[model samples]
Target: MTTYFHTAAALCLAAGMASAQSADVPDNLDKLSNFQSTGVTEFTFIEQDGRYAEGIKRTLERITLPDGFKIELYAVVPDARHMAVGPQGIVTFVGTRKDKVWAVTDRNKDRVADEVKDFAPSLTFSIPNGPCFSPDGFLYIAEQNRVLLFPAAEFFYESPDVAAFNLVAKGDLVPPEEESFNHTARVCKIGPDGKIYISLGQPFNVAPADKLDLYNEWGIGGMIRMNTDGTGREVYTYGIRNSVGHDFHPVTGELWFTDNQVDGMGDDIPPGELNRQTEMGQNFGHPWFGGGTVRTNEYKGEEVPVEVVHPVVDMVAHAADLGMSFYTGNMFPEKYKNAIFSAQHGSWNRTTPVGARVMVTYVDAEGNATSEPFAEGWIDENDEYLGRPVDVAQLRDGSILVSDDLAGALYRISYGE
Candidate 1:
């Protein structure tokens, strides 16, 4: 055990501060010969102006993964966000800043995206939170307060540019009162039961009113479930301040989501949340209770009840957990099975820098999420972030693709036996 710890510590030390070390560190393992690194390694972590850059600003020349995997620059795009893979090796993703939805297809089977095209442009929204493929072979796009559905034909290998589908759902979600809510356009795919799960952002950082809504409905903040055709809408979970990305656990069929912590609650008090949707309408404390019961700065007088649901995992404060996905691919090893990968969009308010890379929630046999560093070095000690991983997607060959909205590029991580 001591030897294992020592080796792990040595590896961490060798990785070094993001800036002091060379980008192309030699791989010590030879047992896995199929792994290779991509992109440039010698670049400085800090920008030329000495200011931390947000999002993926610099092009990723290479990535370091396990010994058997190869990392490469998959595509050149702008602001790639959430992505959903299709049965025919189709990669569809939304561009948060570019305000478009793009598709990449591996038609030639060369393991690279040969054809890239924009499937949809920003029609009536600024930020597109998610682009998911439904079980019925339709593309579901979430624009703030609305859900747009598109047929699969518009994006098939040789299909037409525009899909035949129409806008199926819109922002008919009427939160009790209409007092200017700060909403995010986030909607997950319909579950096996055929209910569309959508997450709503809290009206403000904390519950703004002295009196909570729904009889001070315990655990009820901003999550709702509705029928696919936009009927039978009901609140699924409460106390969710913000949910940027979410998905069902592949094996357990459990729901998991990333919730950003309320700001101005101190530098480290309110860490972000990786929560399990264990029960319908379950509450993971937000304004009234959060950061493990650390009260929000805005509403300090509020009290948290004993029954408030605690977070399954607490990530670093201000890390900004955005998109998340489960790893079911056989590309890496058993250690990555069902692991949750989340993009930390980094922080701007905290004096000490936080977030900017990807984090893996290690899953136990019981499918609980435990926080761990799956990917790092995005932030250098000099306080610079080269790439901000926004979302993760699984390729046809079991490899993983990460989109960097700032750098406007896609990176691939492929592994072998």
Candidate 2:
């Protein structure tokens, strides 16, 4: 028997007994009472008042993929960023650059969502852009300046009030003075060692010299890890500009991540990065070597103080590579096994825009990597973006889920029908 813990809250909204007294639904717990309906049914395509549906259809027609692969709309989620599938494969929790974390579920096993709603509408979230799950069914959400843990979130997400606890309190993830509106998309992943790994993007194009030492010490401009209980905090990787996505290799357990390069450079120089870190305390050049040895304007003639580890693959300049996952499922062809699928969020700084597609990197057993476009045509011939892929996550059944913040939708890509 399934036990619904917050049945009263769910019933109040379902019975239409609750209403918002204010005209504007402020970002607070008060708005939870107004979410009587889940908004949209699963598997049903959302047209976003018709025009968005037309755009999706047109974009799908233009998209090119490998033979036997197909993509379809999964759900409509606003400002979706990173995603994590539940332990039972029953639900997919999505985070956002905005203030909400959505729970997407397919109750009937039709490979399409049945319900899409805010996970914890009663609680206000701040740039909760990353969601990850531990092997034990624990869901951890990494926000701009805090982290929250929801035990068994997959089961309890249907209700407005779910169990949640703070791992990192407000204003404690980083120093108060260092907080910035830019590059605050915190991403988390449970490492092979059972610790929580998170990327803290440096809040500047090129960090000034005065803040470099402090940034390194606090692990501000790089990745940091701590225990699941949120203690014993220390820096894991350093010297990164901003990394929105990362994953551990299934075999090697090495850390692989995508880093956005410094902007304002020419359209064709200082390419984006797909980096790998084999050991702790590794540095991937930031202000010193800007993408791949293309020196930054601030420290062009100065000497770099630390040894810099170059990226495994230098992608196209201003591609804005974001989330990535290693394919360990058996549903795809043999060539896709152990390959990395990453999302290029597209470039806004480039005159001739590029990216806004899915990229795949094949990693040989010897650690050599080669990359190519896997799914494309998100950018039209006029260079306008029809959809911007933010993150990619592999479903339990071996299909892949791609989130598009621009389109306010989630897409499912499956091979072999």
Candidate 3:
């Protein structure tokens, strides 16, 4: 039977049950300023009744998977943006509005984060988005337009105060002279080859805007790679307006990314992209191209008759595909091996919301993509959003962790026969 529960009622039930298990909630603080004392925490998804509540509602009733699986709450974080799980089992996530990078530890070894601490503060920029670990084991954080690197020691340090963390290297990897655009550039990942890759968003809907034309001229739409020490910076591929979630294909060893297309365009004209990075300096067209050849008028002033890149698969326009990862663990069935699980954060500017559900990108042996919805019911028929899936990570026991920044909750999906 389908059950309908408001945000407040659901939280009341969850909080009451959680309080009996562990009363380790933080001392009603506005932020996670203390890292050491507030290291251990249990996340609860409670709805707000007053204005202080940020209108976030935890909508996911349960994380549905194949038969042999169960799910539960891991931890709750405020405004948890893009997260990166390090090699040492450190659960690090960025707080976009809270202006901090938090590292939660699974101290009890229960495969869940029990202690939460701050790794980096908003020391540099207004917002910090993408947080990933470099191949050499250093933590890289994207502070708005700039990228900063923190040593592994600083990342894993389980202190309650934010001042205990250390800073290794902090600077702008992409200088204004090389490329210029306030696209809120972010370092998304560092490949197995010891190279770091970053994603650059588009400054404007279309390219060649008179205001900031450098991104248009520099061909700054896809991912860029550089040495772990921030050397040998080169454009990995072009024509991606804004690729949020990216991971190296486990079988193909190719980098796969989810591209967010432009807004205000027709409903389905410019379908978003899921592309495989084959070579360096390749073009995946944006502004001038959409779902292959549906060109827009933005390229009318093309100096050299601009051509763009083609996406390997066009899932759906305005689906808002975000955090994605390949299931390399043995917890799921053999058919799920090497499958891609992605969260569509759902669309706001669109007439019909297309995302807000977790979908699986089924890929063939040759690395082609076919998508199907796996987790649903994140939105109500009344056009109200309940949860927004931001990112996904795997635990030691082979279960998956999904971050819902909308409700400040973390969910774990596990399977057993």
Candidate 4:
């Protein structure tokens, strides 16, 4: 054990890592991979039970799910935008729009996370809002301008440092000129083809004439997939405004995603979208058609340049459809089998707030899709948001976890035992 500790200590922090990095925003990934120490030991921890956490639990009581289903506070994860449950079912990593990726563990498997702490305290993360695990247990974090891969993350997360490296280096995921915090919160998933797919929301309300060629070539307004080692990078899905959530069909293996619509077109003009991609390089109509064939004001009355595939579900406008996952677990009733569970992040500037709930969709044999609210009541009678759900992920046991950035917590939904 001593020899192993010495070898691990020599692996990530050779010298004092802080002295070698910038004082303002410290990042020692290269040094860590080179077998050196960062000299940073302080870690931020979120209390599991306290007054702040009690408030989040109180809000969960208001969440109304279908009968026989229960929702409870899973963990207190601040700014938790997305989640990736480990293959071993040991720990769940939660990402944020800010700088931290939380490692939440339920040591005894009680279904309530007993520990919530920052993962890799030595690294500086900017908008690390997407986390996904490979079947072999490699964790990939999609950041604003980088993609990081943590090998055996579930096993190594107990320490402040672990085996860390970049799958896509900083400024290489997208061009520097295209970097904008506005719509750059990336989400990633390991696809059925064994490739890592990531969503790149273009940093504009509408794609301009000058940026069309560049955006099309670089997949700035779409999803891109690449090998696990970052090779074979290519655009898979094309021409959508901003998609924050995507998943693969279990039986068919096709890609499906949700896209947020163009704003300022009134609260009810162009609808938000839940799209299905049967083929690669299929354009979903960005500047040409806002959402569900509603033409964007910037490109009104012009023949759309590319052939557009309309969305499978035309959601309510400005509902801000974000993350989604297919219901593959058997804990819920048979009706939820193969259903799509997604989150609507609530309307920002509408006259009266809407959404802030979880939605369920069922696709029939003939390819028709129908959607309805599965869990709701986060929006109060006073037009205020009690919680805004961001993403949905399933645990090893069949229960699903919903992340809320507004309330900064994770909630677990389970069916009858």
Question: What's each prediction's TM-score?
Answer: 0.77, 0.89, 0.78, 0.94
lDDT of 2 by residue, 299-403 (tens): 999988889999999999999999999999988899999999999999998989899999999999877799999999899878899999999999989999999
TM-score, predicted candidate 4 vs. hidden true structure: 0.94
Give per-residue CA lDDT, model 1, range 351-406, as digits (tens). Answer: 87888877878888675667776666667768877777788877767888787766
Predicted model with the maximum TM-score:
4
Q: What is the alpha-carbon lDDT of model 4 when measured against the actual structure?
A: 0.88
- Residue range with the least summed lDDT across 10 consecutive positions in model 2: 40-49
Residue 72 lDDT (model 4): 93
Output the better candidate (2/4) by TM-score: 4
Query: Model 1 TM-score?
Result: 0.77
Candidate 4 residue-wise lDDT, 120-225, digit = tens: 9889887899999999999999999999999889998888878799999999999998899789889999989999999999988887878988988888899999
Models ranked on lDDT: 4, 2, 3, 1
In model 4, what is the error at residue 371, expressed in angstroms? 0.6
* Regions of candidate 4 where Cα sits further than 4 Å from its true position: 1-25
Alpha-carbon lDDT, every model = 0.62, 0.84, 0.62, 0.88
- Positional deviation of residue 56's Cα in model 4 after best superposition, in angstroms: 1.4
Task: Provide the clashing-pair count of each candidate structure.
Answer: 14, 2, 17, 8
